[model samples]
Target: MSDSINIVLRFALYLDLMLLFGLAAFGLYSLRGQERVSGAQLPFAPLLATTAVLGGLLSLAAMVCMTWAMSGVSDWIELWPHIEMMVWETDVGLSWTLRMVALLLAGFAVTLNKRWPTASLGLVLLGGAVALATLAWAGHGAMDEGARRSWHFITDFLHLWAAGGWVGALAAFALLLRQSEPRLAVLARTLTGFETAGAVIVVVISVTGVINYLFIVGPSITGLLDSTYGQLLALKLTLFAVMLVFAALNRFHLSPLLENARQTGEHRVAVNALRRSMVLEFSVAVVILGFVAWLGTLSPEME
Candidate 1:
């Protein structure tokens, strides 16, 4: 029961941080000045602020749950000493503390929109990346040591950011599609602007995914089939491939069609098509994250 709760919390946190980072980064790359914070393009300040605060709360709940699981203490008073020891004595604690701080920083960063929109967005990205990177501690990377540990951590970090970027972009597009006042020009620009970044995201996810697999499961690819973790991993990879198909359709087909429709002043067909594709892609991404959260809790070495 506790394990289930932990996985759910992790999934929520993962989604939260990814959006917090990916959307902010997307705004910087795709949206022009003032549009980012002026609520004219994307409601950057309010949305990010809400996500940041929720992340902090989720982090606290996960920490308390972890402390209970580790120490077998249910009461807050009894858990205090254990919490102190873990927070001060263990690397996991350190990472959790830093994650909390990053979330807080993001919360504060979002509030600075009036004074420094671009700077605030940059700060949010920094905070989101830090918070996201800290999740590596909860994964297989934490078990490694020495030089191999550093290398593994780097791969994990890159893999996370790339995945987050893709997830966040999907969410941003979905949100925009739902807007009452559809700015077709801005939508077209955003779709077109993301081509290069989208390619980079795919390449990074693929390369780092393979590197991460090698680090976690080694060369014994056939051995993985016997374990539940391996099964989930396989499912995740298959879904990712499906996700690629959607992306390709959007990029090579739907996006161009939208541009043509924009010129023709009749984009309802293209818009509706993109809306369906994005919803499906985002749904797949959600399932993948759930698998990720579950896989993190299971041992790949299970035979």
Candidate 2:
């Protein structure tokens, strides 16, 4: 029961942080000058602020759960000292402290978003990145020692950031498509920009993914096939492949159709198709995150 709660909390925290960072970064890069101004385009500021607050709360809950799991204590009073020890005397605690601080700054930055859009976005982006990257400290990377630990953390951080970028952009695309009457030109530009960004994100995720696998499972295909961790990873890769298919369809087929629809002023069909694809992609991303949360709880050796 406690394990289940921990996984759920981790999944929520990961998704929330990703969306908070991804959405803010997308607005900064995809939207043009006046479009970025408050209320001129997508309402990213409030959304990011809300996500940051939620992520902060989830982070706190996750910490409590972690302490409970480690200390084997369910009573709140009994758990207090254990929680304090974890918070003040461990790397996980240090990382959690950093994440909370970043989340608080991100939340505060949202208040300034309307008045200082550019600076606010930058703050949210930086804070979100730091908060997300700190998760590496509590994962498999933290199990290692010396320089290997550093390398593992670096790869883990990159992997999280790249995944966040892709997931967040998908969310932005979905929201844009759901708008009452989205601007065709703006949508077109956004799609084009996402395509470019997607390419880079894919490369980073792929490279870091392979490196992470090598670190976690080594060069043994047999190890992968024989272990539960390997099997779950295989499932994750399969879902990722399906997501790629949807992405490709959006880029190669739906995107061009949107371009034509923009020119002809008959984009309803294209828009609906792209919207459906984005929804599917986002759903798969969430499921992948679930698998990730579960995987994090398991050992690579299936022990």
Candidate 3:
């Protein structure tokens, strides 16, 4: 059914948004904290800078997909909805254009790698705010009316910020394990900090996601189990649960191994494991984005 397909699609979009922002957040945090400890040998500076630029490009693509997915056109009408006109028009439909510009600047700032505290911090704040705002139009708050909408918006924003910061730090974590690299000690410290930050972000996301479902999707338990929106939501939750599994492995099992290896002056295995885990996380993130995209298209039934 079209509805079924839409549900699947929604989950993908959600995953994509989370992954994209997650990568950016990690990049920003790493750029801020990791590089100082990493010394000049490790390429944390340029890596984070490139990730920021990639995040900008990804943000643009996501905005376009969001626009196309939301026109409410079913069947073939969905295929051709003034795509040509949008291309030619000077006035873009979404406010995300400004976000794209800001992200581009953020990318530039990072690449320049000077006075990063001010430039990078400003970019993170602005970009984070804009990223959160985009969720409103992406339907985080739009389904509800009045104060409920406001509540939904705030919760979703917090959820996003938390997730972004948490996941974004993963990039920094990844930078630590580059063969027999000497930055192992520095990487260990950075990873420890990220572990703490990630915990806080997870708690925020769980709390906010629950509030969103309660206020916007209705308070009944049955609503979460029986509806199309509920099913999609459940699926997102499931994927997140799986992501947490990998996160746990990395945090508890692998991270300790990495630290031990660093202390022992044996680094290759830990680094490789870390790299593999990160890649898996990234792949899962993509699937989650597709689901989110589909979620934006579905209506949470009120009954």
Candidate 4:
């Protein structure tokens, strides 16, 4: 039944990633685009907001599943004294910390919108910093070591932040599109800011991802492709590639459509195209996250 257990574990991890990234995309879109549009449509704010709330909730569940799987694999399986039990004791403090940071950012996104740049910047920096720092002692980063370990930690931290930013911005963008507002200029500017931030985050995540492969999977390419651990990593990478494709389509094709709408006054077409692209992108991100959670629990081929 080890195979069955592994399958179940993979399934749970997949769900967790999907919920985390999917919610992030929804949140990002709402934060970035919601205020730029009219209110006649479903109002992208509520849908994306719901996505964040649900995504956060699901992410918490994913974490629990991760803890369970990790404990089982490590043979720390004393049912009564498992780390899973301590999640509410002292270990969960970090989880709460990150959640608080996320909530604070969400609040700022709601209240600030565009009126108070200073306040928004301060909150973003503070929340992002705290969220990133906490990861050093939290789940995956806690296990890294040496010079390469720090590299892995920083990259993972940056990846989380970037993922949050991209997903949150996506949520905001969705709202803007839903409003079908005739103001294409506002949407274009917001999308530009999002693209810039996303580009940086993606670079950081990619660099860190490579470092992680080197440190965790080792130097041998054969180790990664020939082992169970490597196979799982490959699967996660595949999902990530798919998410990247969707993100590219949204960034290149749909974003330009928004720009064109502003110039040509075809607001409806731009909004429809952007909205559809974002939704697809968000869905793919969620699936990728699930793979991430599962991968975290298994032993690397090098190990």
Candidate No. with top lDDT: 1
* TM-score of each prediction: 0.98, 0.97, 0.72, 0.65
TM-score of 4: 0.65
* Clashing pairs in model 1, backbone N/Cα/C closer than 3 A: none
Error of 1 at 210 (Å): 0.6
Q: Which stretches of candidate 2 lie over 4 Å from their true place?
A: none
- Backbone clash total for model 4 is 25
**Which of the predicted structures, 1 or 3, would earn the higher lDDT when compared with the native?**
1
Task: Report the lDDT tens digits of candidate 2 across residue range 256-277.
Answer: 9999998999999999999999
Which window of ten consecutive residues has the lowest lDDT sum in model 4?
A: 36-45
Candidate 3: global Cα-lDDT?
A: 0.60
For model 3, what is the alpha-carbon lDDT of residue 106? 50
Which tens-of-lDDT digit does each residue in 1-303 have in candidate 1? 999999999999989999899998888898888877748778888889888999989988988899999999998999999999988899999999999899899888888987788998999999999999999999999999999999999999999999999998998999888786578999999999999999999999999999998888887787787899999999999999999999999999999999999999998998999999999999999999999999999888774
lDDT of residue 109 for candidate 2: 87
The list of candidate 4 runs beyond 4 A from truth reads: 1-121, 132-138, 145-150, 180-182
Comparing 2 and 3 on lDDT, the stronger one: 2
Question: What stretches of model 3 exceed 4 Å from their correct place?
Answer: 1-94, 115-118, 178-182, 223-226
Write candidate 4's Cα lDDT for 104-135 as tens digits: 56444534524553344344444444433444
lDDT of each: 0.92, 0.89, 0.60, 0.55
Off by over 4 Å in 1: none
